[model samples]
Target: MQRSSTEGPSQYPHCLSSGRTQEAHLIRKGEDMENENKKSIKERVALRNSLVKEALAEFLGTFLLILFGVGSVAQTVLSRGSMGDPLTIHIGFTLAVTMAVYVAGGVSGAHINPAVSLAMCVLGRLSLCKFPVYAVCQFLGAFIGAAAVYGLYYDAFLDYTGGVLTVTGPNATAHIFSSYPGKHLSILNGFIDQVIGTGALLLCILAILDNKNKGAPKGIEPLMIGLIIMVIGVSMGLNCGYPVNPARDLGPRLFTAIAGWGTEVFSAGSHWWWIPVAGPLVGGMVGAVIYVLFIELHHVDPQKTPEEENSMKDKYEMIAMS
Candidate 1:
């Protein structure tokens, strides 16, 4: 009879208490989920912004690259009253590419050229999603840069031995831009040159970018890349125009056609155009494969730790700055 006081209503109160506690726990979990969602959204937004910035950097970098590279050609051609010496063109392009790389290397990896981007993609160094974005930006930048060159050299265009602003004329074809090589060199020869030239160029690029390479100094990647370009230009400019990068040749080549060089741009009468596009791509793949097999696949020296690598990078950066 005395225990009856603890029964009935008290039991109901206990049940209500347990239900309230369960509801509170669920509300807390919901709040946590909301906070987590907010954090994810912020991260996504930040990543999106970063990608946009990188793309813009790429656009600007490529614009400058084409401007200087093709602009140099216009200057030499107009000033000297000739297409200028081939060696001069070679040297001019070499320096131009080097300078562009140095200026934009940090921002956009200094790809500046579509072929380089493509090669990076094939080598697994660059994401496939970024390939089209980089290529399109590079192509547009080339056209704009070419337009700037045309504006600067308007008077020179008039004096050009080739017809000015005409896309399809005999004089314009040879003087203003490249034409299919005469006498029809064997495809094998052209292919060989392109493979060798591009392979060498890609090899140099890999070497410079490899953190494990004792000789590769950080910040000096651009200089080394530039020097390699110069050497290639000097050594192979004549043989195949040494367009080891597809973007270097095609982007500017397309602009040249649009700026009045004409349809002949695609005319590799003997299928020569394929050489430039195919050679560099294949050679780059081969080079990347070789690098992975020979250098990256091998085990790293235990002594060469991340701290050592960082130190090396710092030293290189200091050297570059100096």
Candidate 2:
């Protein structure tokens, strides 16, 4: 049949519209199927135990911390300081801390250090019951991280030490895994150094997290904390190498003891094994208490003061008139 010009235009557009409508419907159907598949996978794999999930996060976070931090030290020591310097160790730890926090902060707050966990508990930021579990996971993670570094650098270790590991003297490699006091440092001085260093750490952390006191900008807390660690390591690392975290020190120490260095890692620094553990625990609490007394307690009420309230009211009235 011959069609009028108007009828042909109208029918052509209707066919085009029908085709477009079918295309849209097909697209929507495909999207719906994809979404359903994603939902099914999530339902099957999602963790049900909150505690276990958090523990795994803490474990992995601490593992990453020790892996890089100790790996840096190993490189420097094995290369006889030719590859990297003391500053390299500090920078490595800074990056390690920052990255670890980013990896686990959402789930476990990345308390890779037992001292930090205990401090959070004491400050009421973390539950007291969770502290033990978090601490244990952190320790285990550090232990595994140390093992990884040791295995990775096993050839370097043999080359550096000639297959003999000692805790002290020219070829001692124990300090690569754990902290040891300098020759000039006394046991008492080492303990004091750890306390001061860890106290400063906790003090700065509490200040950073206090919103009323103007906490760090969102998404930068991990970086800030990492920088704080760098500062502490540079400024206070002379004595006992600033092992402010019990898990950071002990886990690697235990690993070294088992791996090859024997028990001397614990006994070398005048039986200094306990100072890093006890000092940080005490110092963290002290720092948290100090922050609460000096700054946290002094925050003004969130409610607006009468003078500010009247100022706001006057501004509203001025806006209405304008």
Score each candidate by Cα lDDT: 0.70, 0.90
Prediction 2 global C-alpha lDDT: 0.90
RMSD of every candidate to native, in Å, equals 13.8, 3.5
* Model 1 CA deviation exceeding 4 Å by range: 1-48, 81-84, 162-184, 302-322
TM-score of 2: 0.87
Q: For model 1, how does the per-residue alpha-carbon lDDT over 22-81 read when each residue is reduced to its tens digit? A: 999999999999999999998887655655666776777767766776666676656764
Q: Please give the distance, in angstroms, between residue 147's alpha carbon in candidate 2 and its true position after superposition.
A: 1.1
What would the TM-scores of all predictions be?
0.70, 0.87
lDDT of 2 at 112: 89
Candidate 1: deviation at residue 233, Å? Answer: 1.0
lDDT of 2 by residue, 1-322 (tens): 9867777656688788999999999999999999999999999999998888889999999999999999999999999999999999999999999999999999988888888888898888899999889999999999999999999999999999999999998998998988887889887888788878888998998888788888899899999999989999899987778889999999999999998899888888789888888888888888888889999999987998899999999999999999
What's the residue-level lDDT of 94 in candidate 2?
94
Off by over 4 Å in 2: 1-31, 302-311, 318-322
